[model samples]
Target: MELTTPTGASILVNLADDFIHGFAKMKVKRIGYGAGQSDMDFPNVLKLYLGEASGRRFNHDEITLLETNIDTATGETMGYLFEQLFEEGALDVVLVPCIMKKNRPGHILKVMCNQADVEQLTALIMEETGTLGVRVMPHAHRLTLSRRIVEKKVVVGDREFKVRFKVAFDSAGVIAFERAEFEDLRRISKKTGLSLRKVREELKS
Candidate 1:
């Protein structure tokens, strides 16, 4: 299948012939349906489900971590590699400075992704960095909080814009913290000609 973005960039994805499958752990609370106009042999409708994560109550599936040490790669090359990894469905990418063999300074590039995308991401890393081999730790368990995005409007100067906040909750459904997205705050600061600190203060109040 081919997917195209708004900027005309395209991505080609292959599917298995036997079955199409995806894994998600969620606690479904409500389900709704929308009817389609097209009449066909089967029901023409769309299903929408709303739910929260199962949280600590259930055993969650593990994610894969791919790591490689690079001593000869340049910073610019690593930066480009990170962008590609994100575009290819990496959950997270981290680069840490460390000392390799022979007391040489280098970086440890770690990538987190699901099992489905491990092969593709690993191949991209190898092709981009020329790393002889990558270390893979499959089935690494992750503890994540349940989170959702909420919008709040803040007035800066004579204009107002909505800022999205990430609200995280505990397993018992209690809110842990809510913080405005940094990119949103930065955009507000640029438009209002205010310091980032000022924008944050205003949002807080």
Candidate 2:
């Protein structure tokens, strides 16, 4: 019975530092698994565990990056693709303008997503841009901070508005950064007849 393939063995050898006979108590953050192709009596799957050991401070994760080059897509097509990708659970999508071969202006579409979403997102990119191939870079390490939304009450002239701000905290529970939601700001600006820049200034003050 072959339990581990060459790739699996190599991963274990390179990644594992210690081995134990019994399980230890820990907090599990996430669980991921890959399906195996075998007709076995038992469930054939390779599972990966992400956990926080005792007294651990920060959180770490891995994500998949998918990129493709598009020279024929119009602005409207790019906008639709962005909406679809985000609706399909993409963590972030960015388009970088570049010059392709023959001095053709193009854009590089980059998508960040979880490993589970790699397939669908790659397909979406191909379908949207008509690209024959999409580059997949899996297991990109990521360090993330804890984030929460805080509601703030702001008085703009005679109007009082409640705005939501996203606050990020470091491992030591100190604030790293805070950003107001742009949609909220845009709405406030439209209603108050103030320019978006003026609204931002009011928030800063």
TM-score: which candidate is best?
A: 2
lDDT of 2 at 63: 90
Off by over 4 Å in 2: 1-58
TM-scores, all models, native as reference: 0.67, 0.68
Show the colliding residue pairs in model 1: none
Error of 1 at 57 (Å): 6.8
Candidate 1 segments exceeding 4 Å error:
1-61
Query: Which digits, one per residue and each the tens of the lDDT, describe model 2 over residues 74-154?
Result: 999999999999999999999999999999899999999999999898888888888898889867988888889999999
Q: Against the hidden true structure, what lDDT does model 1 obtain?
A: 0.83
lDDT, candidate 1, 27-145, per-residue tens: 88999998866677777776766788564542246899999998878889999999999999999999999999999999999999989998899899989888888999857987677
Model 2, 115: alpha-carbon shift in Å?
Answer: 0.8
Prediction 2 global C-alpha lDDT: 0.88
Error of 2 at 152 (Å): 1.8
